[model samples]
Target: MDCVDLTTVLAGITLRNPVVTCSGTYGFGEEYADYCPLEALGGITLKGITPLPRLGNSVPRLAETPAGLLNSVGLENPGLEDFLVSYLPKVRKMPTAVIANISGFSLEDYVQMARALQVDSGLAALEVNISCPNVKHGGMHFGTDPHSAEEVIAAVKAVTNLPTIAKLSPNVTDIVEMARAAQRGGADALSLINTLLGMRIDIEQQRPLLANTFGGLSGPAIRPVAVRMVWQVAEAVDLPIIGMGGITTWQDAVEFLLAGATAISIGTGNFVNPQAPLEIIQGIKGYCEKHGLTSVRNLVGLAHKG
Candidate 1:
């Protein structure tokens, strides 16, 4: 197994493996430092941060579904200034790459956040989260519209030298269009299929389950949709993709890689098992060994070979 290389390159950045912790689920990478060795994973995408601090949504922000979880966290974070002053330094010391996820209400907000991150020498890349369904004015609004998504990506790219990844939404009408838009806007990579918009009804109370009335749906139920979107986007664009949505096992991650994702991220799976990423990392290595493969990169888009 030592001969099998799990290392892969994304947007010119080298990753020890392809398993990255999805933003918003892994907190700021510090919460899980004790639970799991942060250095063992490929990368950690810090929780979505904004130019200004956000308190997030009200109570009843989370609901559990049959095979999935619904969350309306509303991009809660300590804001860019505090993160740079306090968290970035600690994140820099970690062995894995630190990818910052940024969300915004306006084009300027994205630009401002990108500019601030430019001076952070510890940062690896910027994941522009335009697909947050929890927010009202921005978030999914920009992601659903191709033109708006392009505008935000272009604006951020103009302000930062760091590699930029445009995270796309599954709630859109045509995921491929959005992917192409992001590529044209100068995104170095793309992360597909942010949680699908969903809602739950409290039958007894006859009201919405979440206080926000709606939230993003994630878990095994959305895996098929996520893979489909990743494959579609991969075929449509030339940029590297970080595919995520309901990936709970190495098999699931491998399915995404075959579907055309250059790498994969663990989201809801993290909540179910803190060691999920590490386990998946080992699983991928084991799988490569079993298949007589020398590198995990060889598995990307293998399903398209036929």
Candidate 2:
């Protein structure tokens, strides 16, 4: 307990711990201050930012399955100006590294969002979400094409000098190719696997459960897939990997790190248990101490023997 260290890396950025609250789930960094010590966790990725304020989708945006959740959050956000003026200042006051997650409808849109965030005071980096299905364009629903993925990454990288991470979609047939394309376009790091495309049918209503016929599936159901994708991309790219999917416990976070992920993010789990991230951090520390592991670094990539 006294000698274990949980510090980890994400795109050359060293995190004090491997536990991060995924974007959207944690809201703005300030919202979780009461739930968890802002400085104790690795980092917080702010809700997806857009060029203009969004109202988001209509009613019935979220649905829960047996072991997963379906969502079409529509990337609703307060736009760049409001976030910088209102949110960034408060986030900067916290001791944790604050990451801004940006989404766009086109390459130009992504560029504008990136340019706006590059000058923000408290942000540590920008995570380009190309895998959001709730959007009309530019998200993974459009990023499945390798050319489009590369173009989007290149366009965004051209405008911002901040460390950029391209969040990859799990819906692609060849995840490694998309990861490689992102790197070729100058992605400083990569995060996988954003929810898989899926749908839920309401037998009583005789229609889709979510307002959007098809939503992204996230939670324990997708953990194995996310883990495998992270392993594959870790082997395929030179950049650091921010692994996430259905992680709800410290053991899950440990598995991600073992699979080559530099850091881990908890998404849907946050909705079920607000204290899940804090518990995970404690669990990792306990594991390291009991096993006599001095630093968490020795665990990364331990599962990829090849």
Candidate 3:
């Protein structure tokens, strides 16, 4: 009888739709402007930034696999001041929601960046990259330990005035444990399953393909794992979930929604099909219309019904 309601809100920010572009893939919401209209999608999660500028990993930073891609891009960015001075002003006026992704090797690093960014800076929310290794802790990953994850999230939450989204790492013993830790630390929402730890080697050179040796894996190859994590975490965690990691099509996006993601973010999929989000948005509407569902919310976590 009426158009399907596509709007969805996460972390207090209302999105035009439940589709978002993952950070580190979308370049500050401009690179894809010529291909995908910025206004058509839900939000854009800008590339991850750090307190200081980084050159990122050296050459051979990306490798292609059958159904995926591996990257060791490090956290290369223009640092905090440069982003504030140059980027923030532009993104604030973007048609859709704009989210800032922050990465750090220490709790202080996260806190420092958190202090600088907020709704006033034109960001709808802050996605904390706790998946990064904690250099202050003998190289152990912060997302792997419940205590470390909680402490880091709390520190960032305390300093940042914007909504804090804890981006969980999939390379953990228990995804639920990390989700709970972030909640305990007062996270506003959760982005489930960042890239999984992976690597590739060149036979001729007899060395690792990525200069950093290990890299984060993304794309279709990791879809099943990502969906599983979203399903598991949604069943246990109470916060809104942004499901990602290998969503290349409308079907994949719907799977995440049914698994309980309040929203679905497209990452490596953009590289494969720059227009994927537009296609997905249309497809999702069609799906809702066919099912006689009045809103996208009606479809979320439907699979959990027994």
Candidate 4:
């Protein structure tokens, strides 16, 4: 315990630890402040923001599965200006590292937001969410197509001084190809396993459950898939990995770290228990101490040794 070090430096951003909260689930980093103090975790990814404020999809945007939550929130958020003027002030002062998540409809839309958030904004990194699956003609196009992924990432990296992390969608046919594409685009790091595209049926109504008809599926159900993708990407891509999908417990976090994730993010888990990050952090430390490891970073990609 005395010698263990939890510090994690990913994509040039320093974090006290490697347990971060996911965007959308964590809100603007203020909503969960009461339940999970910012100082207790590594960082918080602000909700996905677009160029213009969105009303989002119509009602019935959420559905529940046995072990997952499907949501069609449509990246609803205040426009970039509101986030900069109203949110960035407080976000810059948060106790832990802060990462901004951005989504857009077109290449230019992404470029517009990246130009605004730079080093002066006090952001540790920029998570380009090219994988958002809910909205019609959203950023998923950039996420699924390798060439487009490369182009969008390179475009964002060109304008923003913040380290760029391309959040990849799991809906792709070849995850490794996407990772390679992101690397070519100059992404400093990769956040893999964004929600899988899925939908549900309203048996009672005899129609699709959600008004949007489809949503991003996330939770414990996606953990295995996330880990598989992280392992696959880590094996081929040189970029550090921010593994996330359905990390709810300490063991789930450890699995991701072993699979090659430099850091792990909790999304729907936060909804179930806001204190999850704290518990998982402690659990990782205890695991490291018991194993006689001096740094948590040593856990990343350990499984690959075999």
Candidate 5:
């Protein structure tokens, strides 16, 4: 049986396929291996890690929406030391590309984390989570402003020669400015449409649904918005994009690629169906065959052509 080759590269890191698992969704690549073959995935972004271990958010860290899930997991992970000593060695043995996703409160924190990861030869790349708030700089600063984004990206780039992907946020007036800023700061690739900031009210209980009051919105509800953001940024920059948000099937994946995404990440859908990535891989093959496409790259950015 002929299948569409899902194999693709992101910022020079060769992934086995295009169906990557987003950070903070899959826990770690090891967890998925119990349910399905980890090698089938393009790559896995480990949950947001800090320089020090995090206990994460309080109770009710997760809430469910129509077709997605909201999580304020608070970047829970065992810090860089623990990850290097334990997780990294285990992940290195897996065939899938491994990425270390990092979050920091200040510029120095980001640089420190990058330097540590830089010394590790097993990691395929580093995903700088610049969307997180800068606790020392005052309220909601990083994602909303290009200056903050550049500062964070520049700091990390100075310490690591490894491929760096700047993960941007959707909670901004213009995503292009931020994308360009990250690129200027030396980001090898851009990943976008993180999550739309949202709030859920429980009318029956007369309170908020989540413990954090507001959380990032994901799943099918945000796919269209994600596509638009990816399209807008794709036109504004030359860096490859790792597009994600509400991807559940091959058709959705194709839509993102058509909208200008170089690769797609399966987030909410992975939780609903552990084998979602495999289904998407198969679906993409069928779509390519029916359309007489020799390579999936031919379908990228078809929606924006004038």
Candidate 6:
């Protein structure tokens, strides 16, 4: 309802709602424009972009698991230049905020992409994807180590004026340490539980299902892990969090908000149902109205109150 305030402020950038399309799943905002109104959702995170074009991982990049999917699609995208010239213009026209997702093999690579995007006035923020598992260097490596994570965050912050969000990896000894590192490095916000490292084996062929052997696992199966990590990170750091992983329905989104995410991102849910994001947005509004809550922000971290 228009009477209910669903607006959420994430690291100073205000979102009309809490539902955002996760990067790597929602191409650029244009591909899904025909499926749903781009402006209706809170924001859209562009697919990961690097300094140079990426071919991504080898074939057999996707496989299905019990309640999730395994993907090793690397950070496949046109280089930064192509995106700026071809895609950014179209994204600028969208009514919703456009969050650029950047990945790199080195600290320099992250810095380069950040510096290049500084001139784009239409961009809302930069999501530093440090948890990409398919890349050999500078992907999960930086995210798993606090020192490396801090270096990458600090470097990008120095070169760019946009609010920076450090996307953290679940494949770590202590998720809280990683969250603290990002905050210490001056990250404006954080996105937790990128994907759990997993794989499937073709018993008949006696070989790994994915050509990349190991892939990031996502879907309902990982929701519990995602919630736990979000709760832990919330307790450890003061920065706002964009919670994702296995968030398919409004109920799932509510679980994330209760766990402490200021906002939520829909990933594999997009593939299952293109309208999932919009539906979840409406569901949240309905829930707030029925519960007599004036603002959606009141639902955040409610589980931590006890």
Cα lDDT of model 2 by residue, 132-167, tens digit: 988775577546877888888898888887789999
Listed per model in order, the count of residue pairs whose N, CA or C atoms clash below 3 Å is 0, 1, 0, 0, 0, 0
lDDT of 6 at 239: 94
Candidate 6 colliding pairs, count? 0
Cα RMSDs, all models? 1.0, 1.5, 1.7, 0.7, 2.1, 1.1
RMSD of 4: 0.7
Give lDDT tens digits, candidate 6, residues 1-306.
357899999989999999998999999888887787988999999999999998999989999998899999988899999998899888779899889999999999999999987636588999999899887876999999999999999999999999999999999999999999998899999988798999999999999999999999999889999999999999879999999999999999999999999999999988898999999999999989998888999999999997
- Looking at model 3, how many pairs of residues clash? 0
* TM-score of each prediction: 0.98, 0.96, 0.97, 0.99, 0.94, 0.98
Task: Name the TM-score of candidate 4.
Answer: 0.99
For candidate 4, the clash count comes to 0
lDDT of 1 by residue, 69-115 (tens): 99999988899999889898887888889999999999999999999
Off by over 4 Å in 3: 133-140
Best by lDDT: 4
Q: CA shift at 14, candidate 3, in angstroms?
A: 0.7
Flag the better candidate by TM-score, 4 or 5. Answer: 4
Enumerate residue pairs that collide in model 5.
none
What overall lDDT goes with each candidate model? 0.92, 0.86, 0.90, 0.94, 0.81, 0.92
lDDT tens string, model 4, 1-306?
Answer: 567799998998888999999989998898998898899889889999999999899889999998999999998999999998999999889998899999999999999999999989988999999999988886899999999999999999999899999999999999999999999999999998899989999899999999999999999999999999999999998889999999999999999999999999999999998899999999999999998889999999999997
Model 1: which ten-residue window has the lowest total lDDT? Answer: 115-124
Better of 2 and 3 by TM-score: 3
Ranking by lDDT: 4, 6, 1, 3, 2, 5
